[model samples]
Target: MAFPPQVRGNKVDPDLLAQLVPGTSSRADVIALIGSPTAKATFDDNTWLYIGEVTRPVIAATNTVLDQQVVVLTFDGSGVLRTVERKNQDDSVPVAVVSRATPAPGNDASFLQQLIGNVGKFSPTQTDTSRSRQGGATNPGNF
Candidate 1:
């Protein structure tokens, strides 16, 4: 069975963005034209970003990114739009994932060690007080 890809964030329209004249459009005007951005620069508020991603579920039970876009708008100190940068999936760098299992202390237990791990660990002669307190294992004649 196939599952539909999930789309997140707003998609940028180049035509509309092209109409915005740099040095003329203010932060408020940009917001009015394109709505709120997905994120702003961490260190500065002058940079705004419109990010979109399409993710599909893989057999490994994790979502894989199919496509992504990031439209970045930079404004000057006066809040006038200065530069607009658009990046697509090809611009992104692939990061290698480490799937190696973490090594645990004394994890190499033998089959026999596992099989007899609980051997003689409990007292066989000890009566199960819980069963006796709960009417014992002997079933009542009828429900």
Candidate 2:
């Protein structure tokens, strides 16, 4: 069976984008035309970003990116649009992920140890006394 690609983030329309004029459009005008941005610049408040992507499900529930669009808008000190930049999938840079796992402080058990670890930990005859003290019925028939 085929599944539709998942669309994420806001994709700007070219017609509406054309209406945004540098030095003329304010932050409010941009918001009215294309809605709010997906995110603002981490360090600079004047820069806003509208990012979008389409991903398809691949093997083992992993997703592969099919398309990506990023629109970067910069505003001047007066809040007037200074520049508008658009980027596509081709402009993206591939990032390599590290496969090394971080070592956690714990005992690493084997497959057999993990499978039978709790074998004798629970006793079938053991009943929680706390439940009986709290006006709750203890099911002696249940193990």
Note the Cα lDDT for every prediction shown: 0.86, 0.92
As for candidate 1, its clashing pairs are none
lDDT of 2 by residue, 53-115 (tens): 999998889889989999999999999999999999999899999999999998999989988
Model 2 Cα displacement at 84 (Å)?
Answer: 0.4
Model 1 scores worst on lDDT over the 10 consecutive residues at 134-143
* Per-residue lDDT of model 1, residues 1-143, tens digit only: 88999998977777878878888999898888888899998998999999988999989899898889999999999999999898999998889999999888886889999889978878744556545556766435424
The residue pairs that clash in candidate 2, if any, are: none
Candidate 2 stretches with Cα past 4 Å from truth are 104-143
Indicate the residue-level lDDT of 29 in model 2.
100
Any idea what lDDT model 1 has? 0.86
| Worst window of 10 by summed lDDT in candidate 2 | 134-143
